[model samples]
Target: MTETPQVTGRHRELLDQVLDKWSLHVLDRLCEGPLRFNGLRRAIPVVTQKSLTAALRRLERNGMVERVVVSTRPVAVEYRITPLGKTLQDLIDALLLWTADNLPDVERARARFDDASAVAGGE
Candidate 1:
């Protein structure tokens, strides 16, 4: 096993922020290309409009995403993953692979734990 480096409190906080529920979903979709607000919402149908807006805003503030304004007839906004965000693609891919590989095991573990808990009257 590889040794893990110690992470400072601030580092952990940032990691949690960047990996928030909606942030990863937004990042994953944005990785494909720049997406308009509605496009992102359509792609990630599970996320609410407010949640996606908040995630995009947080990403833009963190320098991981860029917001562009198009001077069109109706005016348009687009969000794209930045180079900083691109730097995390490898890690993201690894996370995706790990989840895919472990999902079955996770479900089995959950079932076993829940069965044990219910037997003990722990709900």
Candidate 2:
């Protein structure tokens, strides 16, 4: 049997960082190959420039992403997933599968909750 590790405040903070809104998107896209700033932004259309920048910075700080600068007439910067980041691909895939499998149930649950909230508000 596998043992569960103790969870600490620091662990929660790092978990929050790793699983935030844009982190997975950034990491998953980088998994395909290295992409320049504009390319990454284009891949994730809903993300604002500021949000993507911040997510990239956080991932870089966490040692999960690498930033490389290409020197040309006009310099370019690219981001790639590190070895550590690639390790999470399985987890990401699992999460994607789970969402696909359970989407209908989740939608039903959400509709039920919304209906309950509306009924309560009316009462």
Candidate 3:
């Protein structure tokens, strides 16, 4: 009998990192083009400066985003998708499409789960 391979902790960790809200938003914004810090903040209005900063730093460290200093007078930095990041574009688009197609079903399932959990005092 052949055994099936299990997903390692590292794979789960990487999935968590890539699928986070901030990472997805950052990647989506960068898909349009390279953007400065303020530009990214504008594109993702709900993200706090500190959170965005952290997200960008993590993405840069993960080799998914590139940070370039393009100006020196007052100092300016821009974030762009690395080749690896660009490869994720199709995955992101698939996620978007799946969400669009199944959001209602997901919401309905959530509502039902919540109701059941409430009745059972499990929520």
Candidate 4:
């Protein structure tokens, strides 16, 4: 019998860094192509400048994204996914596909949990 490997603290921290709310969105956008800060904001309208800045910094720190200076005159910068980050695209896509495929099952499970909770609350 084979046992599943346990997730360590570093594993959880790395997952949290890449899979956080804004990180995924930023990655998805960068997967399309490089974009300036404002362009990224426009692409992901729900993300505030502050959140986007924080996410970009985190991703850059993790070597998943690269920030480039396109112009010095106006001080323009663009963000692009590094080769390392591009490697995550396939996995992310697979996860999305899995979610789509299993959404009905998930919904049913959620319904069952909610029903049980309601009954317990009534009791």
Candidate 5:
């Protein structure tokens, strides 16, 4: 049996910031290549502008993504995954594959839990 290492507050904070819903989507999109603000919005249609902006700022602060100024004429900007962010690719791919493989089992577990909860209470 492998013991889990201690997760400090800083580690938890970083995970919360980087692994949030919008952050994950933003990171995945940026991984492909550089994209302008509008381009990112279009790529993630469900995210509001405010949410996307916040996610980008958090990613930039974490050094996982970079914002570049492309033009002064139209005030263009683009976001791209930094080398640091690229390091997450293999981990993310493995996680996604794991989820795909285990989703059916997860669904069964959830169904059992839900049935138990319903029998216990309305919640």
Candidate 6:
């Protein structure tokens, strides 16, 4: 019997950090061009300020997003995708496509599971 290779802890941690809803949404918005904090907020209107800030900070810490402080009166700052981040674009796109393809089946399975659980509990 052959054993399947398991994902490493480090890889799992990285995926948990990057695959979060806010992080994915932020990355998708930044795919167009650099955006200021306000711009990002506008682009993703439903995200709370705290959530956006945390996501951006995490990305910046991971060296995926570059934060530039422009020398202006109010100290304008902008966030852009780093080279590493650019590399993730295709991976993100592929993941999106995969999710789209699987979502219907996933929903159906969830509904079936829930129905079975309710029936089992009633017995």
TM-score per candidate, in order? 0.89, 0.91, 0.87, 0.89, 0.88, 0.89
Q: How accurate locally, in lDDT, is each candidate?
A: 0.90, 0.93, 0.91, 0.95, 0.92, 0.92
Q: Count the backbone clashes (under 3 Å) in each candidate.
A: 0, 0, 0, 0, 0, 0
Query: Please, what are the lDDT tens digits per residue for candidate 3 over residues 16-113?
Result: 78888799999988987999999999999999999899899888988899999987788889899999999999999999999999999999999999
Candidate 5 residue 111 Cα shift, in angstroms, is 0.8
The best candidate by TM-score is 2
Clashing pairs in 4: none
Compose the digit string of candidate 2's lDDT tens values, residues 1-123: 999989999899888888899998998899899999899999999999999999999999998999999897698898999999999889988888998999999999999999999999999
Off by over 4 Å in 3: 1-5
lDDT of 4: 0.95
Error of 6 at 19 (Å): 0.7
Rank ordering of all candidates by lDDT, starting from the highest: 4, 2, 5, 6, 3, 1
For residue 92, model 3's alpha carbon misses the true position, in angstroms, by: 0.4
Alpha-carbon shift of residue 43 in model 6 (angstroms): 1.3
lDDT at position 8, candidate 5:
96
Give stretches of model 4 more than 4 Å off: 1-5
RMSD of each: 2.4, 1.4, 3.3, 2.2, 2.6, 2.9
So what's the TM-score on candidate 4? 0.89
Best-to-worst TM-score order = 2, 1, 4, 6, 5, 3
Q: How many backbone clashes does candidate 5 have?
A: 0
Model 5 spans with C-alpha error above 4 angstroms? 1-5
- What value of lDDT does candidate 2 attain over all alpha carbons? 0.93
Q: What is the lDDT of residue 52 in candidate 6?
A: 97
Q: Give the TM-score of candidate 3.
A: 0.87
Candidate 1 to truth, TM: 0.89
Q: Write the per-residue lDDT of candidate 4 for residues 31-105, one digit (tens) a residue.
A: 999999999999999999899999999999999999999867888999999999999999888877998999999
